[model samples]
Target: MQDDALFPLLSALAAVYAAEPREEAGRTARHLLEAGPSHLGAAHANDAILAEMAAALAASDHPAVQAILAGAHLLPWGDNPVAAQAAAAGDIYVVCTLMGPDGPIPSDDFRMGLFWQRPGTYYALHSHDADETYVIVAGDAEWTAGDDTRLRGPGEAIHHPSLMPHAFRAGPQGLLALWRWSGDVNTHSYRMLPDPRAVAAA
Candidate 1:
């Protein structure tokens, strides 16, 4: 898809987020939308899985939602090499970042993206300086935040406080979620707890 395809997607994403009943989430979405430019570029790392996800979204009742996702720039899960290794082993973890300090329309205050993981994969415990929120757009997962854990499915949103340890494992059906971050957007602040290398070795 052309880079111009991203404008509608960004607008839709911002609309959905701005309509969030939660005050904080709505405010954050509006802030990002207002500050971000309409330009976007492609990362194009995972073509096959991107097609699958687009199809799945297209099949949903919300076809417009799928249209928005169709323009995503799929990214390799290589920022954390050990996690990348797990994905290489057929787990199908995919990341599509939409806005960040380094993304198309750069922003220092927040970032938003889509994340997908195949069934049975463990997204190891990790923490970051930015407060994060994940709104499940498809599939299911067992989500953990601090000592709290729950089975979150489509339409549910999970929030993680800044620097709070959390992790999740995709259930039998796999997981697909829309994620947003605020407060701190530094990429260097992400810390994988227990270590990705250790998890890979185990």
Candidate 2:
């Protein structure tokens, strides 16, 4: 059945995090494996943007990437109104939390999911109390945090300390990354910073 597809992706993603050397990421991963899966409602499905990202992930040979692609459609997809506006300007972003408050699989302390952005898009700076990590599954991107900025590629990972303002721009090929959040998982605490691009010019 279609619902059964999430388990493999969950398993593979948890395995990757479990093997991670970072204590917080590893702890969250282990907890995710133990939490099991949840049935997402119809609200989670967004066929247009998600379908395209899923296809890209499915083309990968990585087990975790392919597993997530298998069930991407069934998972809940969400977007920010401001970010959606950028989509109207030809930039796009789609996210689905696998665990935690907004995700299908609910948990008290951790959140995990996928984030997809179209080519030539900029994610503008944002910050949160929860520590976060992203494992790039496909494509490349230039990620920025304050004075720090680096180009990242598939199979690479980035960690952002809690409350650190950060953002990233999708490359010509776009970007698809698996992300996780732990500690202070309150979604209300998420805030968008002043546009760094604008701040620089001023």
Candidate 3:
């Protein structure tokens, strides 16, 4: 039987990403759809892999399955160590990796990364698996390049090549963008800047 219990979890992830850029939303949505529902594996509490998978499915809709998922809940990366740094220079961020369904059964051909924004913040200079793209929504956002800076408003799409240097800042108000990856999610590159503060101050 299909793991219908995972449906609600997919819904929660989708809800959290409702305002994401089209590409990001599409990437994440595709992952969710692909993940579908599955038994996961032989039950093992405290297993790091199993734990993360359960957290990803924690928000499931099916009551019974949700109960199983409810065993532990790790809120989206916030000011938390693993994530605080991701949006610290900025205001919001959400990155989703296929942390569940173990083995070739739940393979990681690609991953989803979505970021939320607050005005006066920058996602900073960094790189990650696959080339990157963003769909802008909500407030205005500015992307900076070594030679120039481009400011974009709602409904605009931007692209960056793999290992290329790029950064972003929300305009006068909070912003939201969906970020999609074209290759392996585990791959990442971060540009070295003389001053991270400069990136933030910009």
Give the top-scoring candidate (TM-score): 2
The alpha-carbon lDDT assigned to residue 21 of candidate 2 equals 82
Off by over 4 Å in 1: 1-4, 21-24, 31-38, 43-45, 55-64, 73-92, 195-202
TM agreement with the true structure for every prediction: 0.75, 0.82, 0.52
| TM-score pick, better of 1 and 3 | 1
- Quote model 2's TM-score: 0.82
| Model 1: per-residue Cα lDDT over 61-124, one tens digit each | 4423564565554332323212433434345476666666775546677677767776667777
User: Cα lDDT for residue 139, model 1?
Assistant: 64
Order of models, best lDDT first? 2, 1, 3
- Whole-model Cα lDDT per candidate? 0.64, 0.72, 0.47
Model 2 spans > 4 angstroms off? 58-61, 79-91, 196-202
**What tens-digit string does per-residue lDDT give for candidate 2 at 1-202?**
6547866766777877876788877776776667666545554666677766765665555547777767677666673322323333234577766677644666777777778887767777888888888888877788886668999877777888898988888887678888888788766667777784735522
Give the per-residue lDDT digits (tens) of candidate 3, residues 75-143.
232221134225353223333332322231243543343344555656666654356666553456677
Off by over 4 Å in 3: 1-29, 36-107, 145-148, 195-202
Model 3: pairs clashing at backbone N, Cα or C within 3 Å? 8-61, 9-60, 21-178, 129-187
